[model samples]
Target: MTAAGYITDVDYIPGFYPQLAPVAMRHVAALNGVVPPRIADGFRYLELGCGLGRSLTTLAAANPQGTFVGVDVNPEHTAATQRDITAGGLANTRVITSDFASLPADLGEFEFITLHGVWSWVAPEVREQILAAAQRHLAPGGLLLVSYNSMPGWAHLQPIRGIIRQYAVLRQGDSAQRVREALAYLLFIRERHAKYFEDNPRAAAYVDGIVKQDVRYIAHEYLNEHWTSFYFAEVAGMFSRAGLSFVGSLPVHTNFWDLCVRPEFQELFRTTTDRLITEAHKDFCANTAFRWDLYARAPRAMKSFEERVREADDIEFRVTRAGVTLPHQTNLDVVTSTVQGPLYQALLDMMSTGSRPLSAIVADPRVAGTPPADVSRAVDAGVALGLFEISARHVDTATGEPRGPYAMPNDFNRAVIASDALSGRAVAVASQLTGTGHTLGDLDAGILNELVERGEDGLAPRVGARLTAAGRSLERDGKPIKDQTEQGVIMAQACEAFCRTSLRQFLQLGIVSPG
Candidate 1:
């Protein structure tokens, strides 16, 4: 391997994107709402470390109107991405191989930027260069998406990292080869020190699981020359240094102070007058895989009201009580009350059914006969009412489109369900209650019921659905949600999460028309 030991080869990972644009666009579009100013004209997107251009490809395909540029230092990834762009016949996207400091002058400014998997793996200098480039290229009101390894969440990996680094240094050249050798040696050490596993089953299980992981992820993640994890405060500070401001998370549900962890914990951390504690808790929850930050060129600080509004805008849709439907109208007094057509009237007719998704309700005879065009029109009208939400159908980069409208990747699902506190219990109950892997509605009911029983009022079905989807995505992305990879366990957990969030979101917005 070269001294720097970057993974320079393409892994032929055609379907490796963490999230797909369909779902993302739904959320982001809903976040943008009707505000044309917050949504940039001639919006340009820039991606740092565009591996094989998978993400950019998805983004370009989904947002045909937008332009995207991706840059990476790895020639293999760049070449493969270029090939994909050509084959896909994408005119809106371009990819180049260059260091952050050597960006092409004609690239122009971007209204949205994403650097996933590059920030924490590079030297501090490169990180700064990337931030500098982001600040320079980003348009005012533009969004920056940065994902990285994070502290406290990744604290357990530090010891493993130290061991890998130590072993890697002993081997000459061939970083992948060195990683393999080191892993073997570590296994030998673990076997000899079986007593360690005896006392700490969880840690031992983690080690065993790591041993079985794809060697590429193992080699690059653990043996890399520069792998740094950050705290929320540090990340915030870095972006601030680069003249960017903290907006929220890409998974909009994640950034909300109301969604993460236990309510007590969140209340303590998020509302704390103490900034450090709040940041520490954020680091603990996110493990720093995804970040959604917003920046403007003029540097006038966003007002608290403006930030809150923007945060709400950036979110796909919030799950809220049925009574609170059309909040932007009743509370904020934003959307017009004028009805558009019979389809719109039909949608409102279904809302009395207590938060059933428009997709589900449309299958019923009352709406099934509606033309696709009319259905879409009705859906958009509800979007105007703040009654019906438009969530993107989940897409997989591995496959052109999901065979179905949704994917319930169970293995990944279980890991996420297992990781949470209340969600875990809700998942367990929902699985038992449904006698199968949980669906969006099942877990949504389970969690809201639990929360209500625990005296938390104002429970909404859409809230649970939104959270569930976020949890499931994390699982399917190979982030390991459950402790064990037992049959169906992971899948159940992930679906449970997806169900909760999706249902919550549908319910929160009037997206669900009642039968």
Candidate 2:
């Protein structure tokens, strides 16, 4: 509850999210007349409100051939992002600290521009500037990703925001304390005014999850000065004004679910286009707050098959040079078992073409039924297994080196190995943090050692053993170091919290030490 307890990036949870970008890119690629600038490598990506650039780093790591630029007004955030970029040796990623309004006149063009966690939190003028920037900088047929708090789901939070805003403004110097107070007040009101949530487990569950988030996130998300939520119609109009059209979302499942859940919903909304259906659905759902939108500049052409193939070929070259593969697993049988399923068979079918970008495969007519998100997940799995490799063309060579935009992985020959490597490392890292008293450094060491012992690939572990060794050294010292706890219980809790909280994706991979 203390102001000193606050962390910078932790508070502003609004920032670039890379996981959804691949799906957005795929949708843009499929649009009419908007082929990516370079069919083979050297694609550009721009992120607005990049925060500390965590997502940008991940994207840079995943797609080595691509170039990334993150723009933000927060000097502290940009500095931190630069630190990470330099430390990770991700030469392909760059950060710029500047207000959106003053973005360079010729910021060049980007195939993918992301405004994740930005639109709803900025002032109207700032939002307009961002749109203008995107309009000017996005390539023909480029992708624009925007996420916001949509209606229906946002209704319940509206009251909470109203209450918190007044309180947070009064306690500007201590946002965390203000958040706790606001939460306590909400809990008190819920005791008497509870209605829809009490009857709906899903709603209750969602609220509970939010409450459990880091207090700083609660403060920034709920109590910000310019915080606002919008309807799909409103956001769609904004995108149109920016010269972008709504495509689809990575959470593509939910968009389709509306039809299945209501049966007639799709038929009734069939006449309407994507934005209208999305708006109607939001109204039906009572204004769901969180969503990711896939938008692309209109008046552009879809990427050609030859161009897609060329991009895939470049991605393959980068991956091979990096020598990244999946993790090695003790229970190879279990993983092998999973691979025999329809999903695995489908993946194998794609990999049979040797190394190819997952995006390209998903776009192919044979895989037309497959969703872009699914392809991303599959590719991520492949990367973990050491079956695939990732490298930035510029990272290996100088900035002038020619490289394509797409990221490719190894074919079936390395698929299992890559999968095992990636899964094992992810699980090992997750396990060490979730249940063991190990640091990220420890997890990194363990995974890297495993990878090396199994077979030395060129993928060097970025995280060093220093953090883990330092933790032990600090424990030996015992005296207070910053705000870290001295008590054994506190230390364990802190380590676990740090691990579980920051590395949430590891949990999704079924990694995590014994609970």
Candidate 3:
């Protein structure tokens, strides 16, 4: 380990990231004209700095055949994850407390190696060790995902972080308490309208976001001694030295050049044949603060439009759990536009039943007359617009009041559902069929937890009781619903919606099973 140990004073929060899933990574790779590791024969997975192993264990439950390992320097994080692994019966995963420099040689190679919160927060020497580990353990043709706080986006926020860290040093208390003090200091400065905050409304607004984050997250984020942001070209150069080349990016949408930049920036992408230049330009246009980049040790490049389409045939897509209507519109950070018309409608109609491979989608008669490239473009835009996903099952977009039939949720999901309300966090539940975690609302999880414990009888009231115990305000029109009758009515309504929509969807995703 580096002389400066990670902030052991506060344990890092566990997380479940769907983008790191093998199925999702493969989908992103295939979209960007690179062949991804095949998922059919099972694969080995590793996570560096897997805080609390939430994602690692959840994924182990989701993909039972895959071997999983997580390494973290903090014993608290590893020990917590071990509890979940045992609780969830996730025997496929193993957690070790070790830094990147001296990882066990016998740990062997992995088809997928990922590090999310580690890269930008560690020292230069540590980053070099990370690359060394990746080069040593990433199998040829395997993919490695590295997510870091990116440049340009973090550029303005750097000063805020620096001040917070400096102020934190003088403050007295544990890490979380110091974080609270530092944030109080930052907010006090911002409230006075510091010249920096006054000049940058975005940075000012960012402080409010920090205020809302979990204190633990704030501590790890702002208190890290080596926290640094990198430009795309520089990070790419570092990865190149490891014999790995860039495959693609995450959120899936970022891979689509046109979707990544606004209209005026379209010409820049069309003019640039080199992908590295294109990525750098996109970040500038979108002001990307963070990025999830995929690198492949032996990437098989797909150069032509036809070749990419042919390779993409094996890739599958589905209507996102949020569902889709053709004229889908969203106001996202990068760009926004309304998506509609025959191709999308055809795609939606085809995926209504379940996920379908691109080959089946294009060959379907509903979209037969459309060109293959057009179908690919629509899928890309749909994914970017938040209307689609690379998934294996379909659930109606969230609607209705939740009600239910109950067999217990999977052990992994039950662990999440059982604890989420109390944890003040709603980590997504694992879905075996999708090889991903399905997002669950807090109220819905509470209701599900109630149903599991007490059955549907008086379920709504029990869920309300849990909510009340959690100090939740049962409100109406932004005011607390003061009448007992009105509160009961509101809980009943929410319960109905969850049962009809979210509960049914959970059934399909295998978050819950049929008794």
CA lDDT scores, all candidates in order: 0.52, 0.52, 0.81
The candidate that wins on TM-score is 3
What is candidate 3's lDDT per residue for 210-281, written digit by digit as tens? 888999998888888899999988899999998999988988778887677899888977777787889999
If ranked by TM-score, best first, what sequence of candidates would result?
3, 2, 1
TM-score of each: 0.57, 0.61, 0.93
What clash count does candidate 1 reach?
Answer: 43
What is the alpha-carbon RMSD of candidate 1 to the true structure?
15.4
Segments of candidate 2 deviating more than 4 angstroms: 1-16, 20-24, 27-39, 191-206, 254-261, 269-275, 282-287, 299-515
Off by over 4 Å in 1: 1-5, 9-41, 194-201, 269-277, 284-515
Summarize candidate 2's per-residue lDDT along 25-74 as a digit string, tens digits. 45334322234334234578899878867667656644556788998777
How many clashing pairs per prediction, in order?
A: 43, 51, 11
